[model samples]
Target chain A: MIQKILYNFKKYKFLLQQLVSRDFKVKYKRSVLGILWSLLYPILMMAVLAIVFTNVFKFSTPGVNYLVYLIIGLVIFNYFSEASNLAMSSIVSNFSLINKVYMPKYVFPLSKCLFVGINFLLTLIPLYVVIIVSGTELNIYHLLLPYVFICLFMFTLGMGLLLATISVFLRDMFYIYGIIQTMWLYLTPVMYDISMIPENFQTLFKLNPLYQFINFARSIILYKNIPTIGQWAGCGVSAVVVLIFGIYIFRKKQDKFIYYV
Target chain B: MKKETMIKINDVSMRFNLGIEKEFSLKQWFVNIFNPRKFKKEKQEFWALKNINFEIKTGEVIGFIGSNGAGKSTLLKIVAGVMKPTKGSIETYGNICPMIELGAGFDMQLTARENIYLNGAILGYSKDLLDSKFDEIIAFSELEEFLDVPVQNFSSGMIARLAFSIATIVDPEILIVDEILAVGDIAFQAKSEAKMMEMITGGTTVLYVSHSLEAIKKLCSKVVWLEKGNIKEIGNTKDICDKYENYTIKHMAGNYDI
Candidate 1:
């Protein structure tokens, strides 16, 4: 099964590229600022959150720049949230193609991943600039950023596929997903400090995949420290487990998707 | 000389659940799982196609004639490998290019030029191949001026023309077309018909479904007349089409005044 997917990947690589590219193009279409909004949107949100948290709420990060800290979490959280949202609609939105063509079903959800991944990668540019301008130190540990990205990507892909499949049968999945996403955002320490959580409860918070990824990412970019091997393993394991389960369910249910959609 | 079988369908059936109210969330599903009686009255199973069996030899131009809701599209979708049959199976040799719906894979926000690549990839054409055929597809569609404009701006007829051009660019071994030629302008329709004839003459097996009886008679060698999800008649085109015309006329005699 894996081999067949890889073979189809090679054969349909261009289709995937075009599908992902179309998403990026349509997202910025007719906007005056165009692709700049992908960067600026997160920066603006971070600024608002930074002010509200640091001044209004009296929250502060002693060593790390609060703006940088909030923005990293926003970018990562935004990608996962946006990617899953798109994936939920991916199958139904392309019902015309599904009704006519014989391409692999996973391509639809996977393309959503690629679309969000591109935006995530592009958003990193502004994050990098902020890190440099703020006098944050860069070290070899920053190379481990890609590993964190892979974890988040896999988790998103799996979650997206699962949602995409369910959404085909039940169109309300997206609305339900929207509420879950809002809940998930608050649960993750996107704007708040993780250390503020009681020490014993921190382990429960650490179990959130986004928490693991964001912590590992901030450790590299802001703290100039490599994540402990346990953190790396936690992210990798979470990604693999979610991805395998997603693919399994998606492949199992995809044929029925034609009728349900 | 004997022709080899290109497509084989054996006892294929498609069943759809009709009345089970869809649950939007796990909470609803869990609640309904205990009390399934709410939707029990509406619980119905409809067979879209029933025990369908057919075989097409290589180089055969077969036409599927059926009224709306007669499962013609369902059968073609099964042949295209997009939908799985509830019962039985189908086996086919060679790559299938299904123009089941014009511009099925097109992105409205992308230019016609960009859509060529997008649609071509959905049809399983490699990027390099699409690149090589890009100019040919554009020229055939006659949308040179609008190549840079997003397809959302194109008229439905223009989209159909573009779709037809891209689909016909390659000489597919098997082509499944379903009522697609009806959408474009008459001139492009005639031109696309000519291109289809050219493909047929080139020995490509074509499975076409259209409401136009004239087209079916002109193009098909063998015709399968389906009614209510079952094959009513399968024979030479002239014989079945004549029967179908007479049947419809006789059946609708007093229902409508001409």
Candidate 2:
């Protein structure tokens, strides 16, 4: 499987670049703010969530700034959701090219992930500005951001691939996924902290992939500490398992995707 | 001297499942899971292509002529590697430019200049290659003034011109065209025909599908006539065109003749 993916990557490298750029171009085309929307989305979500949780709910953490904490979780969660959502529809949306041309099926979903990945990274500029302006101390621990991000990216891609395959057979998956994401957001402790969860359920909550990823990010960015070895293992294991499952499901179903599309 | 085979098809067949009562909605799929007999699925099938066998020599210009739903496009798709046949296999050498769905790579919101690179990349051209050929592509398309304009604003003919320009930029080993010229204007058609003639002279193997019998007779050395997912005739262009024209006239008049 790895060999096949590597071979396809070598052959379709140009195609992948073009696809990712095309996504960026189409997304920003005719829009005045262009990529500013990427930063705006998370910031706006942070504002609303911060006001609600800090004021009405009166939620507080001992050491971390609530805004920084919420932004970190929201940005990471938004990346996962947006990337997977776009990738989910990648196959269905590219039916025109799929019906007429022959290329690797995975490139579609992978390109969407890369596209959203770029947007996610770009939005972090604003995220960092907020973090630094809030007088948070920078340290070497923050350098491990890529480690946490890679975990989130792989996990999103895995879900995206699975969703892309299933969406081909059932067109309703795009809408169904929206509902799932909303519920998933509430479950991931994005708006509320992990402290809100009862002691018995905390372990159960950690089982959620995004929960582990968010915790990883919070450890590095907010707490200025690296995640434990177990946390790293959990993130890596879930990512690889889902990615392998995704590739397996995609390869199994891809031959029939053209027919349904 | 022996001619090298560019494409080899041995007993290729395409089967399509059709007229099945599929659950188009999630709610329907769920309900049907409980009540399996509620919607009876009639499993009707169609043989889009049946036991197709052919070989094309390098530098040969071949034309596939048939009526609608005669499996002409299906055969092209198989050769282009767009769709897999249910039976048998096709072996093709070198790069193939499938001009069947021209402008399939274009994002309508993007400008023509951007789309040229995008479409060129899809056709397996590198970024540097596209960059170098950008001016040539624009000149061929004659859409220089509209370069900055998005494709959505362009007419269908303009889009076709752009697509044709990018596709024909590099002479491909195998060129698969399927009635794409039907969309563009007469001037662009004449220009494209001239370009195609140049490719033919340059030893590009061509597998073309078009309703224009005149073009096929003029350009193709060989012709394959298909009817109802089966090859009816394969011979020199003149003979097949003559027989196909007669067959069409007869079939139109309710006479079962070939």
Candidate 3:
């Protein structure tokens, strides 16, 4: 299994490049703005939401500017949304490749994690520049950015593999994910700060692992605070559990996948 | 001294249902779901392969010649481990480069050059092997000018040439090919056949499937003829193909081409 994993990782690198390149090409191939839309879309949305929510509704996350708050949330949430959304069809979309190789099936979702990981990093560069302009003076400990990325990386991987596996047996998974992702964006406090919720509502948000992840991320970027031991524990456990379950399902159902395809 | 048996298929059987029900009722889909694979496709259980037993010595080339639905492809799939058998054992000493379906793994969306690399890896060609043979594969396929274009735009002959070229790499101990030569024009077919002969001569065990009796007689030293999931005969290529052809003609006349 290890050799298979290693070999597939090597092979999947080339295909992953194809997938990301193809994705970028197809998305911007006809659009007038081209790759500029990658930066323009999110930043534009951030500007609009920052203006409207802060001035109009008077909404603000505790001790964090609305833009910083929104960027943190949007960055993390984009990873999940893009990862799962792409993952839902990753196996079926790469049917031509998957059916041919005798490699670990988890590579499909892992590759999605990689391509979206690149997108996530691209979005972050402009975000960091804004942080510099805002003069937040966050912390030297902001060097922990890499560690936080690692946490989010595993989280995306776990969810990607899980969704990819489920989408195989159930064709309705994509449609279901479509509705769920919309609700998920609102339910997780991406646009609004978690502190905006009523005191009684805090525990409900804690149930969402992604909610905890974003809180930790926002703390690092905005508050110059590293996540507490418990925060890390909760997110870590959730990530591991998803990975274990994802791999288990992937292995059990992999051979039979050809029949479904 | 114990001779090493490179490929072994012992009592392997593959069964498929015609998907017709005995009662011919609307609710059979639901009922069949409950029973699942236990129930045959039709009321009748049709065996694509049954009690198939064969052993190919190391470096031996065997041609499988049979009429349509003769279980030749089924046996190859079992040998290649592409599909599992109903109730039997199949084991191989080393890797199998399975071309059970000629264009099974080819992606039309990819360019010929890119598809060559992707298809090469899938067919068991290592990166090193592909790099060394890359130019040769392109030249042999004669897809040079159009190498960068997506294969979907390419003609059927181009697809077959690409698939066959990719499958030949990696020096797999066992090479399982279906009726891939039916593609392309006469010149290309001759080239492919010559390449296949080279592979056989180079000690790559070949399990070739073809409807061309002449090719079988010329190429294969040993032959296995299948009929309705059973091995009707196994011997020299010409003798078994003759028996197979005579049997096929007789069955066709009796059934009124049904």
lDDT by residue for model 3 (B1-258), tens: 245788888889876545443323335545766885645534566788889998987777788877788888667766776566778898899778776656655666767887786666555556677889998888888888998888889988889988777776557777777754544789888898787677766777788898888877877879998877888889887778888888879989899955
**CAPRI tier for the interface of model 2:** medium
Q: RMSD in angstroms, all models? A: 2.5, 2.5, 4.4
Q: After superposition, how far is residue A87 of candidate 3 from its true place, in Å?
A: 1.6
- DockQ of structure 3: 0.25
TM-score of chain B of each: 0.90, 0.89, 0.81
Global lDDT of each model? 0.86, 0.86, 0.75
Please give, as one word, the docking class of candidate 3: acceptable
DockQ computed for model 1 against the true two-chain complex using alpha carbons: 0.66
Tens-digit per-residue lDDT, B1-258, candidate 2: 258899999999898878433755788788778876665553457899999999999888899999999999999999999898999999998888787777877888899988998888777787777888899999999998999999999998999899988888886889887753634788888898778677766778899898999989878989999988999999999999999998789887886543
lDDT of 1 by residue, B1-258 (tens): 369999999999999887644554566677667878854644578989989999999989999998899999999999999999999999999888887776777888889988898888888898888889999998988999999999999898899889888888887889898864634777877888778778766788889898889988988889999998999999999999999999888778856854
> Which ten contiguous residues of candidate 1 chain B have the minimum total lDDT?
B19-28
- In model 1, the runs with Cα more than 4 Å from the true position are B20-35, B180-186, B254-258
Candidate 2, DockQ to 2 decimals?
Answer: 0.62
Full-model lDDT, candidate 3: 0.75
TM (chain A), candidate 2: 0.94
